[model samples]
Target: MTGQVSVAGLGPGHEAQITPEVSAALAGATDVLGYIPYVARIAPRPGLVLHASDNREELGRARAALDLAAQGRRVVIVSSGDPGVFAMASALFEAVEATGRTDIDIRILPGITAMLAAAARAGAPLGHDFCAINLSDNLKPAALVEHRLRHAARGDFAMAFYNPRSASRPDGFGRALQILREECGPGRLVVFARAVSTPEERLAITTLAEARPEMADMRTVVLVGNSHTRRVGGWVYAPRSATVSAPASDPEGDA
Candidate 1:
């Protein structure tokens, strides 16, 4: 209603995937702040303002949105997937709190998260117990990331890895594969989904030892199947129950 800031999730693909609510909010928003690609996803509307920036400026971008809200201007901090899940929502609120600027009312609208989208596209890969982890060490230490990776691998939990690898941090993915091989064994199934849901999307399903860390990039998400993951329709997912084929039909009796 009144001037406020909303953190909107744009999903993993182009504009069509975004919910109607997010689209409306973006239309009404005086300004939208986010990464360049995310901003470009939405068509240019009259009287709408766009503030695109590099990935590292997420915190600053959120702070700007909050400030605009404080001035009675509608703002939206857009992210690729669900705002709260490894997106800009956390930084937006944290900056507002750190600045002691609570005057701006904030709203967060949910959207199709990459992990969930990947699961649906790859079959029921997440039907069972699973966890989401970001492989990038920009916000956290590599040692801490390694510790978490080892624990997840040992627990045999299905894992959806965000920001799996990038040009800048090439070794992160390699280190993860090494740890998973040691803890989950070499034969464990893993799924490599790149630019998922987009035109350039690519998928590779393979075993832990068979998976190549070099296959990942900034726009990729890697799903590490648990002990139960199996191949289905060219993808890998964890099945809830054992598969059973039906008995042969009595064709002669029907005739």
Candidate 2:
């Protein structure tokens, strides 16, 4: 019998958010592997082995799951949110490519990603076209992050930011706020959503003038509205149409 590898998403910290396909994969998996907290979300049972590792070891974890599949073990690699959205899917494929393994069957199961989940909880702040940006500079250069932010702002696209801040890069979020304030101005709406679907979830909505960089943490996903975003009663939303007028672009067209 041939072995298989399934890269599955756990969604945003809630069992209810996990897809039926992912649940089925977990139930049939002989081995489950993921970051420590994500692996802990899976229940232990007979004939199943769970391998949990630290956060920075994504490539190692991906390679291990591929190896287990090659050894005829049905393996599931778990990631929070969708595996393809800044998660394990790319790493898995990279490992598979490096190993040149074609005999093992590989599958990716999608789940509710953090930005969409956060937007839902905040009343559709991403209703218009938007760009999802990873604010973490661990894998990319900080200059590129700044460059993308300027372009996203210039285009007047709503923005969703992942991994907004961490202890290692304490001032990154602060600088991001400065750029947004300069480009989008002080009135644009910003939403800070922490741990969506979990008991500890918290949501804050404010304008650029009132938004503080300290509101975001590694656990938080920040959303910045396009020029047309606004608050209706207690909820915030961007209109579905881009016909709404946006702020004037800088002279060079890249703010």
Q: Quick one: best TM-score, which candidate?
A: 2
The lowest-lDDT stretch of 10 consecutive residues in candidate 1 is 242-251
How accurate locally is residue 167 in candidate 1, as Cα lDDT from 0 to 100?
83
Candidate 1 — which pairs collide? none
lDDT of 1 by residue, 78-115 (tens): 99989989999899878988888877788998989988
Over 4 Å off, model 2: 244-255
| TM-score to true structure, per model | 0.91, 0.96
Distance from true location, Cα of 179 in model 2, Å: 0.7
lDDT of each: 0.83, 0.92
Candidate 2 lDDT tens digits, 102-202: 67899999999999999999998999999999999999999999989988998899999999999999999899999998888999999999999999999
Query: After superposing candidate 1, which stretches have Cα over 4 Å from the reference?
Result: 241-255
